[model samples]
Target: MEKKMTSGKLELVAAKKFAPYGEMYKVVDFLNKTLKDKQVIFGLTKDEKGQMTLSIYET
Candidate 1:
């Protein structure tokens, strides 16, 4: 599972297929809408198939 935190909200994304860049793009877009020029923090863990536990914090 993926967990996310931002200035506006905090939520989770479910575990899924191995797509690094694509998943990150979704993360970035989510932050952009929520943060609007704020800072971002990421906590990440990955497995062999590139499945990940991703966390984001924005301030």
Candidate 2:
């Protein structure tokens, strides 16, 4: 996900093949706090099929 500098919201785009299973809101809330306050990026790779991505920047 990328943090839009103007709106200060996360933006994610992917194909329909990418479907993540879990409580996304909880995860996003956690990430917002961490990335916004700490300025730290996080990412995870799941083989070559998909990945979880985040940015560490504030507007």
* lDDT measured at residue 10 in model 2 versus the true structure, 0 to 100: 31
TM-scores, all models, native as reference = 0.28, 0.32
How far is 59's C-alpha from truth in model 2 (Å)?
A: 1.8
**Model 2 worst lDDT run, 10 consecutive residues:** 10-19
Q: Write the per-residue lDDT of candidate 2 for residues 4-57, one digit (tens) a residue.
A: 443345333221223454554466567767666555433333335554343333
Regions of candidate 2 where Cα sits further than 4 Å from its true position: 1-17, 20-22, 38-58
- lDDT (tens digit, per residue) of candidate 1 on 28-56: 56766777665544445677887765555
What's model 1's lDDT at 34? 70
Which segments of model 1 are wrong by more than 4 Å?
Answer: 1-23, 29-33, 36-40, 43-45
| lDDT per model vs. reference | 0.54, 0.43
Error at 51, model 2, angstroms: 15
